[model samples]
Target: MHKIKRDDLVKVIAGKDRNKQGKVLNIDAKNNKVTVEGVNMITKHVKPSAGNQQGGIVQKEAAFDISNVMLVVNGTATRVGFEVKDGKKVRVAKATGKVID
Candidate 1:
């Protein structure tokens, strides 16, 4: 299972945005990357198109490697670990004693 999912709060553990917390916007499982809202912003210049009438420099979030982020759980960012409880799979937040369903 993917540790990061849409709407999941996460903290950037590495890169220029380290320590920044944001919600997960998208995930590219095949590439092992995720786009966190307001993190890793990049500028892209686009040519004017019929659909985008005023295509120009646009600032947007870029995907970062999933390994560089830690999921925020119970008010703290922590490493996620999995275990079986009552024959059901579960993930735990190492920083706090909480189960991530």
Candidate 2:
């Protein structure tokens, strides 16, 4: 199972947004990238179209490498570790040694 999922609170560990926390908006498993809310935002210009009534510059969230962000655990952002428990893989919160759901 993927440690990061939609709606998970994540902290940016690398790049310009480092140390900032946001909710996970989406995850792209095929590319191993994730888009966090309010992080790595990019602006795009679009022409007026039927689907879009107001066609103009729009700010959108961009996907960043999954490795660049870390999950926040127990009020702190920490790296994730995993181990086998009861014949199943379980995620461990590195900072607190607690099992993460």
Q: Pick the candidate with the highest TM-score.
A: 1
Q: lDDT (0-100) at residue 85 of candidate 1?
A: 90
Off by over 4 Å in 1: none
Q: Residue 84 CA error for candidate 2 (Å)? A: 3.6
Candidate 1 TM-score over all chains jointly: 0.89
lDDT (Cα, tens digit) per residue for candidate 2, span 1-100? 8988888899998999998999999999999999999999899999999999889999999998999999998679987889999998998998898998
lDDT for each residue of candidate 1 in 1-101, tens digit (9 for 90 to 100)? 77678899999999999999999999999999999999999999989999899999999999989999999987688888888899987888877758898
Task: List ranges where model 2 is wrong by over 4 Å.
Answer: none
TM-score of each: 0.89, 0.89
